[model samples]
Target: MSTAAPLPAHRLFSPARVGAIARNTLTELTRQKVFYLLLLFGLLLIGSSVLLVRFSFQDQFQMLKDISLGAMSIFGSLLAILATAAMLPRDIEERTLYTILAKPVPRVEYVLGKFLGIAGMLACALFLMGLLFLLILFVRERGVEAEMAASLSGDAAALAAQIETLRAQVFHPNLLAAGLTIFAKTCVLAALTLFVSTFATSQIFTVFIVTTAYFIGHFQATAREYWQAMGGAAWSKAFAGFVAILFPDLQIFNLVDEIAVGVAVPLALLGKTLVLGGFYVLIYLLAAQLVFAQKEL
Candidate 1:
């Protein structure tokens, strides 16, 4: 009897197979009601941006920016939590993974597909909300400028100067940077959730673990503070370094304060954040594929 040697490991990462898996995964997600709910929630959060302006006492531009950014963060996080948890296990529970696994589809392909599917959903959510936020901010900024011009009886030059300053604040580059940072952060969270779901027995477990990670990821700055306060003790420093390696350094993507106040972020830093997030996402998916390949469905 001749024995067939196992296929090589490098074949698992083939782009063609990964692309096919991604397409199928995307199609499946589009057919679900959960996708619609997520879309609706995103829209609702965006629409509330306008309403939040009324409470700002005509500081509507800043208010609009705040609400819009906040909405993106909240909605993105929730979508990541819910969508990833339901994707894989639902298929496994229905024994659908068996059908897919029986074919030429590799475990790595399946995991990559799952991650990209959720990433696609996150991308859509971000674009939709980000566009709406931009439009609302533009309108609010213009309206506020008009109001300021009408109320001020100063010289034309002074009035123009005031409007320009306000414009600088409202249409700040940092605000745009902040929004993009949040979008990037959401992608990282989505990838993390998908990675966790690859091995989790239940959606609850995925949710619990991802949420904990999210909290810890957000606490990167706090963790640094603790390490500094500990006087650089070896164990404390080691623990902090371990955390830095294990969890996504989410603080890199937090530009909320800068956005709200219009602080400039270096282009280098922005590029670094994207690269860091992409690296983590790739590592996570690879790790997930390793575990999932041995899982008995």
Candidate 2:
């Protein structure tokens, strides 16, 4: 029988190696046809926004804007939780994890690579969906502008100013910033999902736990405040506080409403979101590596 050659004395955590795994993971996920949700998202936005605009009688662009951003947040959350949660569990279940780990690859690299892949896939989905959303808003803005230009029989300057204001409100940069906040939220959630996948009993368990975590995190602030406001006993207050401290504060990313209405999201807030999200992701990845290292095949 032929003997296998030993691994070369090289860094196991090279970007090239990690990137190869990441690319493969991304390709695997794309083949699963998750990107097709873009079509469903587009259809929902188009169909609902049109009906909403017809019934509301005004502010068509804002209606579309609100709905599109809200949908993006929902889609991003679904992707972050489901994609990362399923990756490691599926590989382990199919014995693919053994095949990879039996080679020269380190467990840490596997964790990081899988995370990068999920994050890359998520970024692509968010961008495309956001683009389609913007395109819809663009068309709506043009139609609204044209209608106003034609309908107004008085001051041309005033009409032009109104259209300009409409343009600003419709194509606001704050919306894009809001999308970044959404992406940041996705990153932290994805990392948490990855951490869970390393130790959960099954893929289904991982998904369920992380999904529940996200919902809890989303309402963490409100729950904490309610419990603190004399509606509960000391133990309940302690439990609520513990839950709030356990999950990343997702309320910080609740910028969709503010951005949808043209309110500026402070630069400082965006910066803090990125920093905190990144910190949580790093912590989760490190924890995953430690747990995975001790995990039996």
Query: How much lDDT does each candidate structure score?
Result: 0.76, 0.85
Candidate 1 has its poorest 10 consecutive residues by lDDT at: 33-42
Instruction: Give the deviation of candidate 2 from the true structure as CA RMSD.
Output: 3.1
Worst 10 residues of 2 by lDDT: 53-62
lDDT of 1 at 49: 61
Segments of candidate 1 deviating more than 4 angstroms: 1-14, 34-58, 145-166, 230-241
TM-score to true structure, per model: 0.80, 0.92
lDDT score, candidate 2, position 33: 87
Model 2 TM-score, all chains together: 0.92
| Prediction 1 global C-alpha lDDT | 0.76
Displacement of residue 182 (Cα, Å) in model 2 is 0.4
Per-residue lDDT over 1-297 for candidate 2, one digit per residue giving the tens place of the 0 to 100 score: 999999677885788878988998999889878888788899989997778766532467777888898899988889888888778877987788888888888888888889999999999999999999988888877877788888884779989898888776677778779889889889989999999988898889998999888889889898888787868887898898789778878888778887887788789878987888899999999998899989988
Candidate 2 runs further than 4 Å off: 1-8, 55-58, 153-156
